[model samples]
Target: MPTFPAQPSPANKSIALCVLFPVFFLAILVSHFTLLRLPYFWDEGGYYVPAALDFFRTGTLIPQSTVTNAHPPLPTIVMAGWWKIFGFHILATRVLVCLFAAAALLAVFRLTRTLLGEKAAWVATLLTAIYPVWFAQSTLAHADIFAAAFTLWAIALYLEPSEDRPQLKVAALFSLAALSKETAIVTPLALAIYELSLALRASRNRAVPKIPATKHLKSFAALSAPVLPLLTWYGYHRFKTGFIFGNPEFLRYNATANLSAYRIFLCLYHRIVHLTLHMNMFVAVACAIAAILMPAIAPRARLSHPVVTAISVILAANLLEFSILGGALLTRYLLPMYPLVILICVAIWQSHMARLQWFWLAGLTAVAFLAGIWINPPYAFAPEDNLTYRDMIVVHQQAIDFLQAHYPEATVLTAWPAAAEISRPDLGYTTHPYKFVAIENFSLIQIQRAASDPSGYDTALLFATKWAPPQNALSLSRHNSANDAKYFDFHLDLLPNEAAAILHGEVVWKTSRGGEWAAILHFPRIVDARLNPPR
Candidate 1:
């Protein structure tokens, strides 16, 4: 391994952290200012916000209002604590998540500075902050940001070169990461395997026999220590919920149903795209690939061999693991890896390009990332991947506002997150809960089922559940019955007018933005005082 610079003094490190954190926090808050007050979107409304509210209201780790997914309680605990101090508000929740994003950026800065230098650190951190997925996630109350923050800090500690490395601190951070989200255990587990491989290789060598192998063995043990806490969490969850992973449906969706070899292969391809090309990340990565072919202008800017190997192992492990694990190929799941990718690309640019060339490349890449935040790709993707999520929330809020203004007492028919939005005031959609009938989604079959009993609800609030762009090639090819049955059950949502016809209602109000849309349908019926009178 190449000799790395000495670690910063404790006092200096503290000062840098203090200065960088507020700067990063303020930048993130300003960038996400408009979105900070918006109601929770998608999974935030569906699961995370509800779970945190349950913990905040009742002090129960297992959410009473929402089905327990057996996710670790750290995020819930943190959010509940924030609510206690700040007094439960959407702004407070978003600000807290921004703090986590800032912390993650600080860790990225420190990691890149240690691996390359200060200049490289600045470029890497700046790019990571503006990356569409990371920027969008900054204000969203999700476990991924919390876990990414802790995981990046832990990786920084692990990679920092010192005579006596802080193995225990690394393990503790890894444990905290896992406690934030169970999937975060993958990082430490990946590192542990990497350490074991190093130990095995050292053992095979006669020159450095026992000492190097024993050192690596110790590192492996420490890295693996995070598993105990994670297992303990699972044990407690099983004791409480009678399931180790989660509800059967959660287990089936995230794990069991994803075990098919073909699906895994498909997911692997998608994962590659997510890591290398999603949200214009290809701009930086492609530049790095081209730069690699050029002669080094500053060979000293290259990362040490061990550092590159470790980062590569981390990226590869996450790529393969997430492909086999997550049901939905959400980009947010790979949050930590984006920083590593950026760090490598920035380092390569610093190594090969002249100062002017490096400046232009980084500038162009930043512009691309910023553009990605507003521009939707020509494929199906989670709205949360970019500002499309904000568009989604805005449209929903408008529909809800219209519903409240005209028919506050009417029973509203909608799918979750809208159902959750209208029913839960704490989710920031309304001051009071509305009567709502929930369906799975806005698909034709689901709408038909709702149509079977139009008397159940007086108003129908329909929205685009899946983000299918007009030129979505994936949607065109993926609409087949075989694909639907084997993979995701892809279904086209009925247009507001079409759905209204089926439900014997008229579209009263509708709005759309950035390919997402929402509408309210009203059904009129005569009420006979003799049969059903007002109380």
Candidate 2:
């Protein structure tokens, strides 16, 4: 592997960055297109969809009020603007996300160099360029890409010298960051701690006079600039949901869905142990550990290193206690923090930037990139553990297209999870535009009971991994109608090696004597093809 130059030279820095920037962008572009556009990630459907709702109806950039994706105003705000250009194509959404990813990369580059020397910055940027978890998300329509940028930018500013106007910029960017996502709310708190540390350091400077009481009060107040927007969000959420944060629905859902404490600790330990086994990734993880340990190992000199300071701040901001932070440990979830992680690696290496040391660091980064591709980090959920990106998107698309071609005018129903996979036409759910009903309404026992009942509808389509017919559904006219119930199944392979067992054919059930369910299951449905995609 090629090595970072032994001595940090400004010219070398420029050349290295010049060579790196294009490579990074190309990786991003290729991943974005090659992933078959990965059509609207699940989170995109749930959160970002509503952000575009206002613009879809009013044709305005500032979308009308919505309940979902309510935390971040900027991404929704940007999405609203793009909705006009593409008029609602999923491609357009991907384009916006790609653009944001590029911009986020630039931010990483800038902050990387600012903290680490130029060589370390290049190493960090290069590693970030190829991190699969981050790469996967950079291609989607989720707001996290932009949210990560805003959050990182806020952290960057706070870490810069106080007199450089970074404090004020930190305040502004921190607000923008917080407004981007609930995860980003950590930005301001992180900034406040770092700024407080800076203030304390300044106060103890012998040459600098003690901060006067009034000045100290004023300084503290200035640090609070980011609080306004956050407080506004809080007040609005309080009035709307009777909660301080936005969208009480998510909390309720998470409370029921997410794993509890004992499980949480187990998951954390599992991930830590899981990552530890991967040689290449473990190297990067080791760097992260060293970066954390450095400040304590040699506090005086470590504090002097701007790069060390930057990495420390990022780690503190991101590595929340296991009790509070919960997620599937997606690389993108930590992507906003990868640049810092990379810098930490560089910081550990830079303190010993011999020619051989540079070579070793470069080799390890390359190993990480290779492992990233080899393991195929599970950024997006996979139905089968080993399912590839092409399998997930391309094969899934075919199943949808097949459905549309075969049942042009029929309502299609899927099991709980599979239902999400095919809720719309653009996503390739095909068939005619039929009303979407949640499969969660039925339990296993109920499904079997419904399966036994013959006096229902004539034919119903089932789409899912596990096929269980719902007994008493709104779409069923009568609970036990002695009607024909034909179970047709579609066997599809998203990839040659991996096949999706789809249960979307037809079901025969009954609705009560007279209701909406009677018409729903009985009617044939297909996409209008006239309604534009979600704007």
Candidate 3:
């Protein structure tokens, strides 16, 4: 009996909505900063921040010694510039990243408002603000959030009524999306599909003739024009490394090494299952299923409604790209997709749930809000089921503290992540107190050689984070004979270096956080034996 207007509200209400939306976001940010004091998260300290520092040091756009151009360089380049301007302390870096997150939140609200009505827009924005993955990543310098920011705003621009130079503006935004992360190449495809769908629907209404195929082709070409910069970067990369995306070693080690088809379905299933189970009281899917049957239940509110159709197409396209092509199903990769889901769910809520007298919507929405508090990186002491952001940051910081206190002047052999963090100048840790030997992979031979060199380290500190496996697991194998396999059997989530360190070196002290451990290891005898193997 009531119709929701799609056009702008009264001028006074419009002004009020704009003011309240930003105030809400500011409050969320202030609350988050007061609650959590996250260090440079796992990837930020280890990979992203280090890479950005290297670029600044070398004055190059590309990260120095980049392997897989797994991500496009723009995010790192931009972050490096930010670090240069603001200085690279953890709080500063995190605050800078939060700015992008803020922008993304605004874009989500604006887009949802355009497609759905005001009530749905507010619901969608609130959901995005509280969504665990998006919220957690907002504080760190990971590129996923940055990429999502670009993609969300680009879609918002693309959805606006066509205007003079609209093609140029949208294409530029899409180009930024791709540059932020290569996976955002899905944007053009989603846009083209939405445009085609609109044309087809118009034709069915007999409002206009079906658009010519050539016109579609021309539009697509214009949409694709901004990709030339991406192509040029690939050209440069190929020239430098003899590979388009990265060097052969990078592909062998990073790209193809851990990739598995099984992870694809696992990724899709986990997000759906986890988010629904945690946030929706398992009602999201049931509601979604019911929406699919809406035509049978209510003739007027088809699931094929245009807003639903457009957002659904984009969400589906993005999921397909990640499942088929993503190297790994990192939670970060799924962050951009969740906001779209929120939009669709809200659309369903508006069109059918209210009219059907479905009380489940109210219950599920309350569950989502309550679920927000529980939505954080697992605790440092949480079980091995998942490694939260806290787990990662605490583990690394503990390792760095142990090294600095115990072997202040010793040469340390560590995986790149620990090495990068300890070496970081912004953390206010003295990098000079310990000489660091950064190694990508662990090896007895390399350690021995480094220790034996006249100018090399006399005492070697072996530091392992959760990501690196020991190059020499021979020690773990030897101990396994004594029924110690359980000690070395790292769960699917952790690396194997801790067991190897225990077997080869005398553990002066051991420390652990979450499922990961780092120990101060002294391996004099093992180094000597390896330097002069049995004849």
Specify the highest-TM-score model's number: 1
* C-alpha RMSD between model 1 and the true structure: 3.0
Q: Model 3: per-residue lDDT, tens digit, 252-366?
A: 5444543466545644554454445433434555666676565433432222344455566677776666555544335567666777777666666666655434435644664
Task: Give one digit per residue, the lDDT tens place, for model 1 in 1-535.
Answer: 1123443334334346678889999999998888889888878888888898998898888888988889999999999999999999889999999999999999999998777767777889999999999989999998999999999999999988775688899999999999998888888888899889888888898895534777788889999999999999899999988999989999999999999998898788878999999889999999999988999974455777778888888888898998899777788989999999998899889889888898799999999999999997766778999999999899999998998899989899998889889988888887779998999888788888998987878999999988876753444334443654367655678899999988999999999998999999999988776866679
TM-scores, one per candidate: 0.94, 0.69, 0.73
RMSD per prediction, one decimal?
A: 3.0, 11.8, 7.9
The CA lDDT at 500 in model 3 is 40
Off by over 4 Å in 1: 1-15, 209-211, 471-486, 531-535
Cα deviation at 113, candidate 2, in Å, is 1.3
Scored against the true structure, residue 498 in model 3 reaches a CA lDDT of: 45
Model 2 per-residue lDDT tens digits across residues 1-535: 0011223334534644456556656666775575534555455654565456565667543324434423646676778777766777766777677767776776677666655556566666667766555666676666678888777766555554333344567667767876676666664665455556656666676785444333433434455666788678767656655656434555544333345655455445534433342224567766546545543432211224544554565555555532245434333445576666665566666654454755586677677665655354322222221123334444445555554555554444434333444554444334345444444323343344434542332223332331112333332223222211211111121211111112222333322211112111233335367876797
Residue runs of model 3 more than 4 Å from their true location after superposition: 1-13, 16-25, 34-37, 65-70, 161-165, 193-207, 210-219, 252-283, 286-304, 355-387, 426-430, 433-535
Better of 1 and 3 by lDDT: 1
Output the number of the lDDT-best candidate.
Answer: 1
